[model samples]
Target: MSHITETLNQRGNRYGEFNRHAEITQNIKKAMQDSPNWATLKPWHREGLEMIAHKIGRILNGDPNYDDSWHDIAGYAQLVEQIVRPPAPPVPPAVPMQNPMRGAL
Candidate 1:
């Protein structure tokens, strides 16, 4: 088979695996929505959780060893944290920038 054809076939298979158990993903998200705190979450929080849930579901249905899904989960959670959590206070510079020549004769 041609290289392009082989690549396309591999992609198609991955898509197949992802969609083969579509209900599983939806069920996971549905259960999450049932949580009492779900309503209280900010929109971004809900989105992040849902995305994480999706990656989780995919991992469950597909390769358990897949590293990308884990990274994706962390990325989504980080994005949610950025939006929902308060920003950390800025740290003071250890040494403030100054003109060396300012005090020089």
Candidate 2:
């Protein structure tokens, strides 16, 4: 087997546990669905990302308990990408300008 394939398999095995965690998956979905608007979603996403960052900082500072930060980070990143997708904008109708020189000096 190639090095890349081995690394991928290892990561897949490690991260696959998160998929099997019903509570985590449900909570992620609930948090995502509870946000009413993009304004609210942005803050929630930022908070999750910040949490992951904090976890990383702790691990870097020698906190072994934060080793599972990758799972949280991946979850949050996936939520942001998957659930926070905005709806398509409504197309505005084109209107002909009555005053062609409206902005002329």
Which number leads on lDDT? 1
lDDT of candidate 2 over 1-105, digit per residue (tens): 999988866754544432444344455555645666535556767666555554444344333454466676678777777767787799999988699788899
lDDT of each: 0.80, 0.58
Instruction: Please estimate how well model 1 matches the true structure, expressed as its whole-model Cα lDDT.
Output: 0.80
lDDT of 1 by residue, 20-86 (tens): 5477789999999999999998889888988988887777776667788789999998888778788
Clashes of each: 0, 0
Per-model TM-score versus the true fold? 0.70, 0.34
Once superposed on the true structure, which residue ranges of model 2 sit more than 4 Å away at CA?
1-41, 63-67, 86-105
Determine the backbone clash count of candidate 2.
0
**Which portions of model 1 show Cα errors greater than 4 Å?**
1-19, 91-105
